[model samples]
Target: MGDQFPPDVIYEIFSRLPIKSLARFRCVCKSWLKYINHPYLQTIHRFKEEPTPIIFQLVPSANSNKNSKLCKISVLRVNQLGTITIEKDHVLDVPYKGWSHQTPVLGSCNGLTLVLYEKTPWHGTLLTLINPVTKQRHDLPPVKLRDTEWDCPSSLQAAGIGFDDSTNTLTTVFVLCKESFWSPAGINPPLCTMVHRLGMSSWREMPQTPALPICDEGVFAHGRLHWLSNSDGFHSANDGRKVVWFDVKMEEFGLTDAPKGGQYGQLVDLNGEVGFAYKDDGIHIELWVLKREEWVLRCRFDLDRPRHIDVVVCGCWNDDGDILLTSNGGKKRLFVYTLKTDDLKEVKLDGRCEAYIRMHRSSLFSIRGQNYK
Candidate 1:
């Protein structure tokens, strides 16, 4: 009765196991490879209570020593109310061959995170992606840099990751600017735009690039990579921030005017739609959803005297429709604000607040009209 455990039965049982265990079970049989990587199983892997990604902070040595860690990250566990009850669980070993300054993380999509590793004087820099759950780290090919060319930075510039729905594969995108040493039009900023797909052999440079230079890392949403850009460089007095996006399916770069507001803002997912959350650096805060290149104001709040702390809109916590806000207090005072009920909670975790926070968007919608085991 070996056939009693039919292929369908085995898949049902295997898909429900923890992601780490399911990854190991893939080696139980060569045929399991196709099943474990199946779209359905991958979606199921994301539904776990974990994945409220906190910054894995790496503090450098204060002794002014020559050698120090680039950065440390935090491991967080979810509490009963689905808040981040920060705890140390795993240490991510990043494979880089340079100083602690070389390991600036770009961002995280799904369960994967992209970290930039600077190469030795012999090598340039490598964009590496690591899956914290599976502990599978993949490094992209080294980016070639010219001796006289100024270095193109990734952290403050632009770095992002997203999924290509067409290929059903996750792709990490990196944009590097080539310095125009001579004339204004001599070189194109963000001249080198590259994409590295998971399980791929090498990186692929794109033919087109964004016109404006990216101000920071890309925020992935709606199957696209979005970043705030400065058309006139960061020094311009009227440095009107614009939203630049790369369509994974079309492989095209485009830009639009960001919602008119303050500099303290971020792009977050609003009920499966592209959302913009901003604070005026005062008591006023606004939330808007993208509606055909225009923004529709969804929510606005004005905090009172003592309650009006610098709040950063992170994302919607759960199905309760409460917006999550992290007060910009020092590391010692980690403030959490729930918008719906005007409730404030202090997250006194051991870990520092990560620069980039990614939401978990898991669904089994991809399995429709597909063949399965």
Candidate 2:
């Protein structure tokens, strides 16, 4: 069979398959394993659209009764009709023993997921990047603070990972802010933005953009990391702009337009474009996708469920128009909203203390590759 098909054709076929199938096919032969692990194949796999039904959930150690430092990841599969089945589960144990803080945020970028551990007032922050498919993890040292004299409780506010097109490498951006005692006075304590290349041992500090208060996690799309600006005053009365974005390629921060008349919503990656989905009343959810710097109303449908305080879009779009979402206030269940039929169904993941999930497509991209750093 190998002799019948050219190497390029075989590589293309392998690249088109799902990550799980690719993993199994690697054991077929040494040549196939080499092809699967090749950087070219990995890059192709990363760029190609994978409408896989796989979902990745990051459960903090605090969420479970266990007291281990390992990060547990649950892999779930959803059928076209929105039925979820637990495919497998695994834990990532960081070999470094410097810190044991609980994990809080899980961000995805170019086939890799970045996990940020909750930072204590006395300890520094530790970040671990893991490829769940490959079971490979890389730990980054504690973030270096510019001003060590600030006695306030400093913590990670928001974090995200993106690809730097200019450098042809992966970059992560996170915001750290010192706690302010005078909340009534509306005094925002200084914030420090940190940037780190994939293979770097240390993080470099980026100048703070005060107008954009990144209080939420970032959604990576179109070569930039975007967040819903926490500051309401930054939005114009007429323009309705609310998003603060950082360019991974240019390494700059800027503002963008959000959906007009939107009361509250979260930023999501609709395939490769920026998407915003907000609740209209209680069960009515409206989806707006960004195209050519304009917000286009994609669709609006009722969730057919009880009212939720917050609606978090899974951002994983399938060919069948199935949208997965989770509520900020609920029983920690998954709501599959089908746009075609305007039906919503709930799937209960038993014993899930936290609903930290992201649409994941695994790849064989090596974390310790020579191209990094």
Candidate 3:
């Protein structure tokens, strides 16, 4: 090879670096900045073999002053040697009304999280795309449908963020349920499925979407957003009320069977595979992984044991193939468990707070589908 490094070699190097570092390098020179917008760069960054870190959001306790708009966002990672460490923990001042609670974390994609802040009484909800690592932020415009959420107040909304591979764009999705809105002719509560593309200034309504509400915001995995249908079933995917997924690239929805005997399950991204954790009994937690579209028994952990008492899964530390968990109802502590070694490590949080998770991907070069960052 010539003195100039092979382009493929350079691509490999960039793919492995955290996106936050890549964002800084984009300012080095014009020649290097050109690659930020290169279409192939996204593919390399996304497909590279790397473990994603888990992000935890800690909010103030109910006893604390609710007027405070500040909260803490922490990044947790497990090194190759199986050591769990806090990569970062910093305070973020969320400048929105009633953001201290009921804050909608609409999933994390490309290291960016889409947040929905709703006014009390649940009106005038708006969105913001934030990269906790880069500290770069974008406030999304207000979303409107025939019946804006304010028009009909309800407790149900399914919102999330995902990457659209076909167009190399990030997407935001929101679905309001069981609310009536004023139409030109009459008041009706339409199946309001809203989508906002990264670069777009407006949110578009998607009709024909199922009217059922999703149980959680949704988890991104297998190139799609997956969530449980608010339908009754007994741990059987064959029940038809199993799992629902939205494919970002194709902008389509698909249904598949859920794990057999699954109950009180939470959808999760176990490494790159889609999986979930559920209480098998009072003492143990059952985890199931989906490989080749087939459900496989991953592993089980004891939650009632003295060491694991009152523990609940928060997310996965995919790097070390470990599960991230929280203990105590107030989410006072975090723990990392190795599936292979059965090792458990506890991470202490100074105070009790609510916990939310986001996966850390290395696509920091692009945010909101813009290359200038």
Candidate 4:
């Protein structure tokens, strides 16, 4: 009867299992392992037939050790009844022993998270690419720039992670500054941006990218890693800011102007589309979708009540079309927004602790449509 169930059917069942169960079931037999690791099965598992919503953690107070330990990393499946079911709680095994409060989780892509370690005298700054579900991690080496005389300032280092499917490579980009602004006038200083590819073990300097303005945030989407940059007269002359995108496959950087009066908020991938969020009047948030090479305002999320303050959007679409946003001002709440219904729902968390949430394939069969395929 086991043979009667085709491998595809078995794969469908296996993909729904949690990561821990898959880890144990991997020992079922060599055939099972081989079947799970099959490239075709991996792709099927990655692109789900239906969309799903996951949780995102927001750590309010970084200094609280107890709160950090209390932070639970889990995936919840929301049903039609608006009930959430926990699929995997990563904190059960993954330790958070020496995690400092200042460190922030940059984001996750392709079942991996880009984590930034807070600055320390001895440790400069470190970017860790980790898979909480698989418990595998890779620490990217420091960035190096050419022809520039600069000391690596621990505070000035910024790093982000992105996956290139065409090359089957995970690329980590680190930006370095010339030096801390020591001069009183803060005059024209020598600055440079350096990118380090993960597997290559070397750094390449971006010369064309300007040094006068700084980037605020960076996120990976649509085969490139994008950052928000202020061009000439960005704030003073025009509300126009440039979207600087680095094509990982080509190792090239280029600029694209955002919509008029559209201030950059967050860059994320929504349902296979490159999306940007812009804050309007400090009250409402509008999401811009890239359609046919044009940026269009697709959806608007309004924060009507006075208590609905200080909203921060993070986490792009999973295999499903749901996006997660962490909202907090007076109180803390995690919201899951659905693209289909245009509905926003609050998720019930374990404790008030600040948490970092990421989505990972629970089973090998869940690998479909990812870079591995």
The lDDT, on a scale of 0 to 1, for candidate 1 is 0.61
Runs of candidate 4 with Cα error greater than 4 angstroms are 1-35, 38-41, 49-103, 142-157, 181-191, 198-217, 230-239, 315-323, 328-331, 338-347, 355-373
| Candidates by TM-score, descending order | 2, 3, 1, 4
lDDT of 2: 0.66
TM per model? 0.75, 0.81, 0.80, 0.71
Residue 323: error of model 4 in Å?
Answer: 4.2
Tens digit of per-residue lDDT, candidate 2, span 1-373: 4778998898898888888677678779988878887867877787465544333334334434343343456556434345553444544444222233323454777777787643444556677887766677787666747546542234556788888755567788877775432233344546678888877767888765535566656788888888877655543556554788888877888887688777577777666667898886777878998777788998888776756446678866465557778766434566777677777777655455353567765556657654434
- Cα error, candidate 4, residue 266 (Å): 2.3
User: What are the per-residue Cα lDDT tens digits for candidate 4 across 52-91?
Assistant: 3333343334555553322234555544445642343443
Model 3: runs farther than 4 Å from truth?
A: 1-6, 47-68, 77-88, 99-103, 120-123, 148-155, 178-190, 232-241, 306-310, 350-354, 368-373
User: Model 3: which ten-residue window has the lowest total lDDT?
Assistant: 181-190
| Candidate 3 lDDT score relative to the true structure | 0.63
Candidate 2, superposed: residue stretches over 4 Å from native = 1-7, 21-39, 47-70, 79-103, 151-154, 178-188, 208-210, 232-241, 308-310, 348-353, 371-373
How many pairs collide in each candidate, listed in order? 9, 0, 2, 6
The true-versus-predicted C-alpha distance at residue 288 of model 4, in Å, is 1.1
Error of 3 at 185 (Å): 28
Which window of ten consecutive residues has the lowest lDDT sum in model 1? 364-373
Task: Compose the digit string of candidate 1's lDDT tens values, residues 1-373.
Answer: 1246777776677667776676566667766766776766665555454335345454544536545444444445556556646555554655333444333667656666777655443455676766665556666667654552555333225678787766777777777665532235433344568776665666777888887776556777778888866545343435556788998778899987777753557777543466788766577677887787787887777644355466666666655545656665454344445656766566656555533344443332221222322
For candidate 4, what is the lDDT? Answer: 0.56
Per-residue accuracy of model 3 over 1-373 as CA lDDT, tens digit each: 1137877777767777766677788778765666655767767776343445444453444545565343355555444445444544553544543444454566776667776654444334567777776677788867654434454334345777787767777788777653543233322334567788877767877765743446667777767888876654322344544677888877788787778667457777666567777776767778888777778887876653565566666566665567877664454567777878986767654444466655555464356456432
Better of 2 and 3 by lDDT: 2
Local lDDT at 265 for model 4: 66
